[model samples]
Target: MPHATIVEEFPKTALSRRTGDVLAAAATGPVCLTDHGKPRFVLMTMAQFERLSGRTDGRTEDWTRDLSPEEQALFLAEIDERMCDI
Candidate 1:
């Protein structure tokens, strides 16, 4: 189950405050803010933001498509360690 978190939607004038709040909660996902029903701003967690930034040490490999339990555990352990360093 996912943890309950607060995502506030504020008007353009209050974008700065919303951004600050979202950055403070950087371990969670993004808090989406909109303008006239269109996505205007996305406040992402540090991890998410870093992934979006795209300058990462991540590698692409075919092994991710399908994995045995042991392979998955090792892969996830590596990812978790990487997450901590990030």
Candidate 2:
């Protein structure tokens, strides 16, 4: 399971007054910007964005080659389960 990181929340108004602080905090992790006490947007560093979005260097490999037979069977089983749900 993936671990969840705690995000700092700031009101939209803080954007103008604390832009520098907000950016500094985002450098460490995600910062949530809220409007009317509800989350409206998230601010994060470009490196964090790229990491979360799966941006990688220009290299590709056949993913299947890395999977063990049992792992492949489990993957296919998951696909079959989802197909049945559909």
Candidate 3:
């Protein structure tokens, strides 16, 4: 997969305090962790990592297309919360 241009970003502290949300966001694309407000780490699915690292063919799937209504709502809510934090 091509590197996701629109990656989700959060403070490094969030990785421990909000691991679930970080992971949920990562499921869609890369999650960028910032330490002292500088980009530090990128979290992505193993498949994505493999594809980007040339360990696998570039075929990809859109798992988000299968999200249930409730799951979609939760994801949106998390986005809203992140927006509020901004």
Sort the predicted structures by lDDT, highest score first. 3, 2, 1
Q: How badly does each model clash, as a count of residue pairs?
A: 0, 0, 0
- Report the alpha-carbon TM-score of model 2 versus the true structure: 0.58
Candidate order by TM-score, decreasing, is 3, 2, 1
TM-score for each of the candidates:
0.35, 0.58, 0.62
Give the alpha carbon lDDT tens digit for every residue of 1-86 in model 2: 22225368899899999987786666556788999999999886544455467773412214335777455434444543475589
Best by TM-score: 3
Q: Which portions of model 3 miss their true places by more than 4 Å?
A: 58-86
The residue-by-residue lDDT of candidate 1 on 1-25, one tens digit each, is 2232335554555567665555444
lDDT of 3 by residue, 29-82 (tens): 678999999998998766556657778643333433477745654554565457
Q: What is the lDDT of candidate 1?
A: 0.51
Q: What is the C-alpha lDDT of each candidate?
A: 0.51, 0.63, 0.68
